[model samples]
Target: MAESKVLYLQKVKNQNVSHILHKIWEHEAISRIELVQMTHLTSGTITNLTQELISHRLIKESESISDSVGRKRVNLRFDNSYYYIIGIDIGRTSVSVVLSELTGNIVDTVEYGTEGITNPEEVLALIEPYVHKLLGQAESRKRKVIGIGVSIPGPMDQRTGKLINPPGFPGWAGYPIRPTLEERFKTKVFIEDDARTSALAERWYGIGRDGRDLVFVTMGMGIGGGIVQNGRVLHGTNGLYGQIGQMSLMTHGGAGAAISYDCWENLGSIPGILKRWSGNGDFRDFIVQVRAQEPHAVKVMEDTLRMLEASLTSLINLYDPDVIVLGGKLYPYLSPHMEAIVENVRSRVFDFVQERVIIEKAFYGQMQSLMGAVALVFGHVQENPLLVLGAD
Candidate 1:
């Protein structure tokens, strides 16, 4: 009975501490009084936890700032400079590695194409030296690395931590990505689906920061989705929540017999859209032709964006998010047509939902995935300072 009571008390204490830490991070720099009001905890508890956090170097006291009436109070801020994060994004076309501070600022980066890469081991081998170089830079700046975060394409088994046959990259099947990195770096590693990571990047560092519910739609070699509900990534039952690529549009085969179905991603993806064009040309040239209103190019694009409008309408109906973020290889090209797409989608959705939802391009542009990987670590650390710092 005593042991059980002790365990219960410990769990409650941890939750309190974690809650306090999150409040400080959310507020950026906050007074103990503000923390007390926000957390609904006793002032004594706030003071003790803040002091403990300061002692552990997770947080620090800032210069005295005067509030209204000139009463000076010391503010507390997260010590983000003390720890570094290594963020890696493994895409079918390329692999990118970044060294970032807990603030989601990238300090260094290296990238390589995956054209000749045939296996998961090769991808890790490509990442290792870049990681070592980034760590050296962090070491020179006296930053302790907290962990490594990876963004990989999905169909992953969370229980196994192995990617199970992601699209485009057959070589990565069954690879123990988490354990391999943890073993090599001698530190904890966190991995998330690429789409989910992109959403995390948006939630923490991109245009979705102000949005309570956000959806990031990706269009590259493939179409994917990442959804954030009330500031947390929505990983539904089995962690397979955001597979929006498979959203069906129509069925094929005989009138009565069922056959393979056509879906949103089939025509909305970059490659799929390009392949549909009757004439062949370079991607950049194709974009220029579309912008120039070349008859064939414009026709192909309008058809694709109409499909996008349908899929986006489906998304709006399903999630009713505050904002929808569009990104990946196809977005820049699609930017010119965004107004039309937005209007078309709005016309089809509910009146109440139409006015509130904003659709915008990703602010981080090409770096969204890498930023997501870094934010994954940032989120984990901010949520559990003691666990992350090995103080628990």
Candidate 2:
């Protein structure tokens, strides 16, 4: 009978632990008292779970505190350093690898030109060494790597973790990214659209912290968006919810719809704009001259702004998001154009949405997607501690 009671007690403890882990993930951080109240569990239950978490290095006592009447209350917080995640952002011209703590802080990053990406195996080979090297520098072993998160140019099927006709990356279509990486590293892997990943990063760590519904717009080789509603990314039936670039903004009877007309990629994609304005000149040199405010360069900037304004207006009308965030390589050059775009949006959007909507540049730098991939790993760990902690 004593042995039976012990087994039953262990089962009860496991259930209570599952509840505590869910609460922490939902709240991000919580006090012991708050956890008790939130879970409606006994103080003993909370204490046991918290002790277990601490022992497992899942959480740590935080430096931040709230002063109580007697002893100060040292806050308990998730220990992001307990593990690390690898984030890969593969763009048209380059691929970037970031090693980030569970809390989304980047420990190290490596950017390499993408001359060999036509061969998927070659790209993976190049990435593996850099990842191992970074782990060595950080004194972290492969066993500590929680997962690998990859963000690439879309359109992709998130459910299958495969690229489906990715525009810029011709050879990557139908690539078995998640399984390939998982097999190679002997670890879990996640794959997501680049724009969607960026949006996730903004929602958790950047400008979207205060707003639940937002649209993250990426203006680079092509334009795309990621939509978040009620704190969850809106992955559509096809797992491509926010492919806003395909929308037809202009009435041109082209292969793309009307929304595609105003899309920066279609009319003013970075390469497209350079091609349009460079006039047989060196495109890189032209951009440099534009940055220096040469007279012709000023005209190119103005043209880019006009297209941007029109595209933003269409987005505001369609989505009515709480906030619209501009990010990607082109963001720096387009910073000067924001005011004009905002004004255009105001003029174009209906009064109700115009009054409530906010347009802003991304708060996070170029590495936002990499950080988001870390968030994806940590978020999963928090949601299902069973994935980390075994039964009792």
Candidate 3:
């Protein structure tokens, strides 16, 4: 076989092994036959891979035997006690850090609100202490930390691991978040767009688990999107594939109109909806009136939903994904009109594609982004076992 083909086949084998290993990790204990049933890898393949993992000390054979009757079955499981990972999420309003076990369970978490501060250094300060605390906790517990994964809001240079002109963090353009984290934590670091990371988490642990092609649209203070195609989060050139919020729907002429700004974020974001509301109350009160179907509240919501429908229609037509997951803070407002929203989107897309795509709510709710940060590390380690397993 050609060298490229050989490497491709090896990658496929590694992916299969990783999938089976994750299945074993999720379950407290699972037998080889069960692994075959869960991952659809042949029993022989599972046996060989599990044996390799056991020898590498990445996984282990459980002392307790399986309850199968025909043959004695030894169970396989991840060695959670052996290592740890840190997952951090930097949002427009808050920063959260989670310590996760090898199996992807959250051992502990630290959070701090940003309160609208956008300076790059200020943002770093907000998260740094929590990151240190989490790292210290892991050290005290005697767990070796292997990697750090972070979810940041912006366009990132995937190759260089630098944030490039992120909208949420104004002064953070061109910051080297990944390299800084790696140097500070002294571990492998990975960075991904916040919304896309959430989509990854959904694929691994939520509703998208059963489907390979999916899109997650987050309607929050800012609008964001995460698109998954063929079971992987799509990262286009420079890793800016999921910046759906910047896609323009219309153009307007005004003072400084040369900028030609009419992005989906300005049109369909929660803050935009709140700004349009004429009432003298806060967001909580506005939501109360919206649920009550008050006239002004209803009108703003209808317009917001219409704009969202237009943006989402464009996305569905472009990607033709199997599912679209709606999430984030604004979902509560959108939930009451979800049936209509989905129907509206379906009506706008091509007939042949509409019926195949299902619209649903996010499984992890608002925690999706934070959880996704952890999933990123787990995913990296799974794909490259040598990172966690050393030269074994």
Candidate 4:
């Protein structure tokens, strides 16, 4: 009984310390008195925890500021230069790796095409050097690589950390992505679905940062979504929460099933728009023709945006997010018609929902997924400071 009580008290103290550390990170730099006020922790406890964090090199004291005449108070800030995080975005067309500081500022980046790559072995080999290259940079800077975050296509089993049969990638079903990366990197690895990471990136670093409720929709190679409610990414059961691409527009779905079997992806994805074109042109050409007012391209895009409006209406009615963020290759095509799209969506949905929900472009643009990876690592550290501090 006594041992259990001691354990409970220790857990409580660790939680308080972690909370204080996160508060410091959020405020960028804050005084000890401010931490005490914000966290409502006792001054002695704040002093002791901050000193412990400083000793571990996770945080440090900055230059003193004059709080009063003849009196100075030291400010506490996260030691951003002390550690580094690697964020990897594994898209269908390319793989991108970024080395970011503890504060999520990107330091360096490398990208490579996966044109001929098919299997997990090839992916592992392709990413290995990029990881090592970034590690070399970290060594030169005298900073340790603390964590690696990966954003891959979805239907992942979050509990097992295994990706399950992601679309557009053959033989990726049940791939041991997390364990494989952990073994190679010798550090904690966090994996999330690409769309979810994009949403998390927005929530942690961009426009969605100030709001807890937002939905991120990706319409590039495929149509998908990520939902953030009350500042938490909704993983749902089996990590399939935000597979909005599969949302059925008809009674029966998938190819060759008739018009009643269509899904949102078939009508709204960038590839979907390209399918309507007779020429062998890619998404870029399709966008070019649309801008040139080519009749076929313009008609396809207008129809696609109408489909987008219907799908978005369902999403807004269901989730009621504060903002609906749009991204992917299709964004460029949609931007010019945003006013029309917004008006169309408003006409279809309820007045209250249409008035409240704002549709905006992705804040970080192409960097959203990679930055989300960095944020994932930082979130883990914030939740378990002891793990990073070598206490657990």
Candidates' TM-scores? 0.92, 0.82, 0.83, 0.89
Q: Give the C-alpha lDDT of model 1.
A: 0.82
Let me know the TM-score candidate 2 reaches against the reference structure.
0.82
Residue 322 in model 3: lDDT: 81
lDDT of 2 by residue, 308-332 (tens): 7777777777777888888888788
Top TM-score model: 1
For residue 325, model 1's alpha carbon misses the true position, in angstroms, by: 1.0
Candidate 4, 5-115: lDDT as tens digits: 877877887798778876776677899999989999899999988998898788999988887676899999988768898999988888889998887788898888887
- Report clash pairs, candidate 1: none
Better of 1 and 2 by TM-score: 1
lDDT order of candidates, top first: 1, 4, 3, 2
Tell me how far the alpha carbon of residue 151 in candidate 4 is from the true structure, in angstroms, after superposition: 0.8
The residue-by-residue lDDT of candidate 3 on 1-392, one tens digit each, is: 69888778667766777787667655658888889898988878888878888876678887756364655777887777768878889888888888888766778887888876877678778778777887787789877777888988878888788888877567678888888878877778888988988897888778765546899988887888898876678878756688888888663434767644478887678667777786878778888898898988888777777788888788887888888888888887678888888888888888887777688888778788988888788777766675654432
- Evaluate all candidate structures by whole-model CA lDDT and list the values in order: 0.82, 0.75, 0.79, 0.82
Please say which candidate is ahead in TM-score: 1 or 4: 1
Ten-residue stretch with the least lDDT total in model 3 = 251-260
lDDT of 1 by residue, 309-328 (tens): 88889898898888889989
